[model samples]
Target: MKVQKFIASNMIEAMKKIRQELGENAVILNSKQISTARMFGLLKKKQIEVIAAVEPQPKMKDVRVKEKRKPLSRTEKKPNVRNQSLTSSVYPADEKELNNQIEELKDMVQKLSEHSSPDEYKYYPIPVQTFLDHLRKQGINGMIMGEINAKLLNDWRSENREKTEQEVYQSGFQHLKELLAGVEYGGSQFQKKFINLVGPTGVGKTTTLAKMAAQAVLEKRKKIAFITTDTYRIAAIEQLKTYSSILNVPVEVVYKREDFQKAIKKFTDYDLVFIDTAGRNYRELQYIEELKKVIDFSQDIETFLTLSLTMKEGDLADIIQSFDDIKVDQFIFTKLDETATYGSMINLIFRNRIGVAYVTDGQDVPDDIQKASAETIVKRLLKGLGV
Candidate 1:
């Protein structure tokens, strides 16, 4: 390896010098900033420092190099050519030792996975289990494939139609359905109540409100009024307004305490009042508490906690813990289009007794959200598809 040090006024200059001297196959090992001072001179700006290396051969292209004066002899003599080398050969270990270390790593991974939160396991169940038995039964790749399928099968079972059936998708689907049995909304039973949407940022509350509103208006023919408290986002009010405009529905924006009271009062004749909330970070319970204070006395309000399917499973508990102060009667999920993996929706649903009411996919108004049925949710979840 050709190791060298390059200094410049800034990062781009330093990187240019490294590449120009070391050629395209350069690796950055470290970086630091050092001040330049002269004995007589007062001071100079801090110089950008870089440590770089070039492999034996020219292994990369499309590289930007700095201008460094080369020795006249270098123009006559060709640059030495050799195979590219990295840190790979610096600490070569015995094959047996490598195997033992690998085994140890696999064990550690499996143990970490076992102690993983229900949410942790939800997102990476198969991959976590696969690392443990990689050498025992099949190659690592084979282990990965098998474990992933097993995980998918289990997820599908949660949403399956029949609980007893052994079919892969059916079983996973069934499991999901059973997990959501608690908060399942039996339509028309409480058609005359207020449903609230609350969750961390970017979980699609406004869109969900439109979905429920559309269902109530078009399908149930129930008089629906949309209410929103999300006035933070620069275009938040406009987004909800857009949804309302397309749906041919009325939307009420409530900023102060009085506005909220008035909206609820205005919607008294409506069958359903779908309330959209701002997505906040779960860690900020103060805002949540403030929100609770804002809407605490609302009559017959059923609050739903919305979460993103793309979030890692481990964060779910943190989310629940943060939102605990606020009353969550049910849960809603949005951004299903962003996730390829279905994590612990079942675990959360079952453990929290929160049934999913709607799922929002895209940004399309009144089109992205859907009523989550046990059968459909199960079928898609088993396929490892986001619903």
Candidate 2:
């Protein structure tokens, strides 16, 4: 393997350098953002550093075939020869074409082998391989994959012959379930008198809140009231009011901290009070601080951080980290239908040590939401793609 490090002002330039020097087959091993200090550490410029490697090509084998015909005399007939090298002149054009085809075939096979699992993984049983492939296709993280692989290997080694495929599947499913254990599950229980939904913009916070409120009113037979701090968008407040009218529930629009407290006071007689917060770009610290000013975290309220499955995992992670100050109670994942991968839910649950309360699949109010659970998440992760 030939390895090289490349540093550039940005990732695009670094990748271009790698592709130029290492061909399109080069694999990126790692990349990171670094800063270079200049002028006695007074100023710094951010840059991207990348490590890439390519496998060495194999040597072509030489095969000699002897002919039975007599050798030609020097004066007989000299074959035409131009500026071409001796080796190139000896081989026919068809032979050169065949060699090129063989080289390309070898390159493709080498790339496939390199992309496959390591040699150690080959020792595992077929059932384990199936589950791992399913998990990988579901976009599960490598850390979680390693953990699951280790458990499956250990289980196989302990009772290798006694376990059936079904048993293996069950064990694998249980392993995943155990990882998400001890965290809260199910839809909003309305355990707290005040329920606050907070998340980034366009994550369907208002619609999800409305769904929970509808569930509370119809199924739980609880008197629910709506309080929205999303006064920045008139359409959002109006949307909430529309749902409020349909459910015959009272809705209050609050702007400042005092308004929030007053709305809670007014809904004292109601069984559950749902608060819809502003859904703007809360990835910034100022928005989180603004949320803190209006919503009272000290009060007995359950704050559910709404997230969209369609967003990238890194962005979702950043959003989750940004809300650390607000002390989110649990997560509510939206747009499940928009994305096939559900690993982000598991990733967030295990990494952040937080629980998931609900998952919304569509824009339909109170129709597409489901209570989140370990089994439900595991099923979604392994759905259609078998164990």
Candidate 3:
């Protein structure tokens, strides 16, 4: 038997090399992953190694005799004792093991061919791998990563274009921008009279609301007022009051639906009325129901769900789902500086089909808060990656 070893970036390619060099009948003896060229133990590259062997052709007479063998009847005795010794010699224990290994390798090849054919990402270029690692660090969802890899590879191959590393990076950035298209990002126009901020506790909902109010009053020169349904939290109410005092905007503390209506009437002449709701443990259904009792969602209002970028993606997804019945129109991500990964925001935006209105990196009132946009978000996601 002739034995040879093959290596490639992935299993599919390794098999291809094996078949090309050793002929179609080559048997894969073993396969494993390996890493090579370690640079200061940081930049090792991954590779796949496959061990293959091609057996020598047996005599035609022996092949024909083996093919002609038939099953013995119950009345027939076992093979002749003399033939048994010859048979044992012809098929030794080691040969039997090798044949079993060959059968297993054949199965592996079959399965790989069925699943990995037409897979372009099996040979991802260095640039693509670098970007992929950066995204993985940003906590981007695995499914999204897979999707980007597949689409990027397909496009790269179909275009038949020789793109430089910079070009590849730009293409990835552009693809992200396309995914975030049709999303409304920025300060609320307040086309509707009421703009409501809602979310769980400590997500900086009150602070974000304050930032929005500041933008509307100082930059847009619009008459604005505050109506908060967060009477449950004295600190929240007090916080809004402080912002209200600073902006010289009138704020009404509402406890019930009637109180909310009265507050709206009181701020009827204002250009914008920002409503803040009490943060609750949204995992409980009663809190959402209590929200319906205290806030009037029936009014012409745009509700922005405030979320923290530091929150885990699973928890963030659960929080958004908890408000599914509440008609959340958009999102406002806060605490951007607390976490390096901004992938949670992107995941929320795409999965919820909602756009981001604002993002706050710190507690510097309006200065920390900026109008969210695709360009800004993608930059945050790829910030330190040098992509």
Candidate 4:
């Protein structure tokens, strides 16, 4: 028998290596996941390790019997049992070892199948499985789900006792809070002179902008003004004008870089100026360039990339990439009430490392918006899970 070990980044590659070395008759003895240290042990990467073995083929002469025994008649005496034993004694050790190896492999495969089966989560405690099901229903990404699963499993094992559903849910909530600890949160600080909202078409940028402006006027008591470059849609301009009229603030319409500069000069005395850019197919580089031509990005502006929670995560990621050249200070996720899946919001914040300023649930100016915090976001994600 021949035996060898192989390791690769994943199971598929490890299987390939084993097949190349051990051929089709090879048997997989065992397989496991491992982590390899990298960069002086500061980092670790996950890898797969597999063990395989194959028996060597016998020579032609050995495979051919030296003599053939004739069948004995029922009446004739049977061959002595000792003769039978002697015929099998040539490779007794090899046969015994192979049987032992096969038994061990069978045990390992049984365990692996039990752990990886479609109903595998059944092995976990009921409370843990319930929480995991909630995460899946929320559409959480696999990476984050893996981390959460590890944390929950570790806690469950450490306790060595079944925990209540609420206890397990709290554990998951705390883990999520820890993951978001390093990120910044809360709404605008009103420190910058210019507040800019940018995003693709029909993402509620205008309403969100109006909400923030209304908050400034009603709560912060700051002298705010609106500078709109959304000339492509006359209704957008009228919408801002409507909000400005209600808030009793001035609105400026700028069409060119010069107009933007002039508007900035006009609003220099105000406490803050909120600029609303046109909603175009930002996926096109030309639209982004046109935005550059119409807005003075060099000014003291804190840009907020507004996104709707109803959009798919891939589209949100692409919109974020389009604004890579622009300095986006934070995000303002709109229409939170429109979608039940909030995992994409958490995914985006974790991926981009950009914090969320506010999440709006309704179109009511300033009333439906709330400043985001790590606790609030996590609570919202874990809401109704235990029930």
Candidate 5:
């Protein structure tokens, strides 16, 4: 069986090259993506697959000897299947396996086709209001924001409600810009480096800590430590412990207000310290009060209130409003991979102006986060498929 491989920027291009070189009968033995050389330090990768022949032809016997030896009778030439008891069951199983593989390949091909999808393909896309509001992120001005957002809502609803890819995206950006106009990232840079990441249930504060710690150690090469006030959740302390192990960083688990100062002192020699707090229902004043006590005790530390974009925009507001009583310095957006689109953060940053310190796209630790910026925010928002 013949085998070959091909690579291209996307699956469509890869398939075209495959057809040109390997012919239509070629069967794909395997397919995957691999990194392309970096362009200006950005990650660039492409799809590729190795294809092989689908079937093998039976080998011929000595044709010349057979022709010369006989007029060999057909009965002698063919195997006596009755005596041989030919293996027939395997053929059926082979056919079944082939069909199953074909279905799997079709799914893979569909995924490849979707990766480079253009604007012509969305259904029930994000609302234009949410879109406009997401744009003017973190004090992005109003009039220019308004001009960009001009008539987008009406246009989206009237002209392209069902299938308007570009129109929807354009209007969506404008909608989100407006949301960004009100919030401020209360800068805590002038304050201490001990920043506590606080958010709702399962917002991934521990994992986010790993990302921040990794950046500090690997990029800044600074002495770093961790402190977790999240003794409530099962294995929560253990999770931070794992990061501490990988990073060779130290951690302190503070369960009481008095232990907090002692905990801070232990990590005080480090250049940076990340604190993970227990996820609490912000609306519950009692829980907030308890958390406030911890923050109050850890008063020297800066704090960032995290919000997961998976939340509806309205929930984001209630979360911020509930936590408003705390001195939130910045924001951290988590679980970006769960949502199909994430236009809401633009508004969140604007509403808060607390600089967005980090965004976690997945649970992949340091691989998922980067320092946040306005350009990064706008670019990713435009590329709404992931965190």
Candidate 6:
């Protein structure tokens, strides 16, 4: 057997080196991540070490012919069917070992393909790689992941030694905080009299509006009323009415611009007026036009684009783009507890240059909602990542 060891900056390079030196038939005996001392031992650079071996070819001179023997009878070959069945039911130990090795190699290749730029992440420490994997599983986009990789690599190179999982998480948190620095967060400041909630169908806009209104009435001790333009759904109107009844706040249902104007006039004496727009297919431009006609956007109003975290990233992006004509002040991410992945929220915020006002976890009136902030968002995103 020909045995050789190969070392490279990543698994791909290591596999290439092994194949080139030991041929395709070579078997991987062992592989592991290793750190090499660098910069006069002040820092360490990560590398992959792989050991492989290939069976040696037999020499022609060593070949010898065997004497011919009589063939076995048919009866002899047909015997022991029970033994054959028993053997077929159980895999041989050697074959099982080979299958395990193949699976391991498959997993390595899968990990390589997961990265958008594998070369860029080649030298990342184990903890950093694990952190990046966690981010990927959380549905973070490739562009954001690439940016994060660069930041992590820069930090890893500057440090004298390897970073622990917790240290990597802290670094990620700090970088995310920096990314979200300029965007506005937190619940309404009450600076605007009319707080309008708008989004596509089934995003829970009416419920979210009720939550925000509940907070204002119960916590802030502010007078608020509901002006719902979601007249398309009788249930939505009733749902708002139910919430309004509980809060002892009045609700005005509007079907047209004149009715909306009258509702605005009626709520003029109130501290805040929550406008719940009809949730329709945002892909249709007419819904937005209808919304414009109903709601006085020119008034002292803050428009919030409510979204469900359970939706796909592509769908969320499309919904955000569909509202390009309207002036969206911030976002309200709903159903936070419905999905384990939260990266879509970060992706949208980073791409659209918008911030979150609130995140709703459940159906509870106000308890499920929380005011969004950079710290709170980053912590939620990095949850269960060894933090």
lDDT of 4: 0.82
Regions of candidate 2 where Cα sits further than 4 Å from its true position: 1-123, 160-165
Query: 296-363 in candidate 6: lDDT tens per residue?
Result: 88899899999999888898888888899889999999988899888988889989999999999999
Kindly indicate the candidate among 3 and 5 with the higher TM-score. Answer: 3
RMSD over all Cα atoms, model 3: 11.7
> Which scores better on lDDT, 3 or 6?
6
User: What are the RMSDs of all candidates, in order?
Assistant: 19.2, 12.1, 11.7, 8.5, 18.9, 8.3
Candidate 3: where are CA atoms >4 Å away? 1-123, 158-162
Give per-residue CA lDDT, model 1, range 238-291, as digits (tens): 987887787677888887778888998887888888888877786667886768
Task: Name every residue pair that clashes in candidate 3.
Answer: none
Checking candidate 2 for backbone clashes, the offending pairs are none
Question: For candidate 1, which ten residues in a row score worst on lDDT?
Answer: 131-140
- Give TM-scores for every candidate, taking all chains together and pairing residue i with residue i: 0.54, 0.70, 0.70, 0.72, 0.54, 0.72
Give me candidate 1's TM-score against the actual structure. Answer: 0.54
lDDT of 5 by residue, 1-387 (tens): 456777764444555576677667555666554667577868655434545343333233432234332256766676455775323322344655765776676566555444332221111134443344444332334544545444453454354236445656655555554544444432234237676788888788888877777877887778888888998986999989988999898888888877787977786677887889998887667888898677553456777787888777878778888877777777888887787565567655665565676777888878987666564676677664222
Q: What number of clashing residue pairs does each candidate have, in the order they appear?
A: 21, 0, 0, 0, 30, 0
* Ten contiguous residues minimizing lDDT sum, candidate 3: 114-123
9-59, model 3: which lDDT tens digit per residue? 665567678778888788667766677877788887767687889976567
Comparing 1 and 3 on lDDT, the stronger one: 3
lDDT of each: 0.61, 0.81, 0.79, 0.82, 0.64, 0.82
- Between candidates 1 and 6, the one scoring higher on lDDT is 6
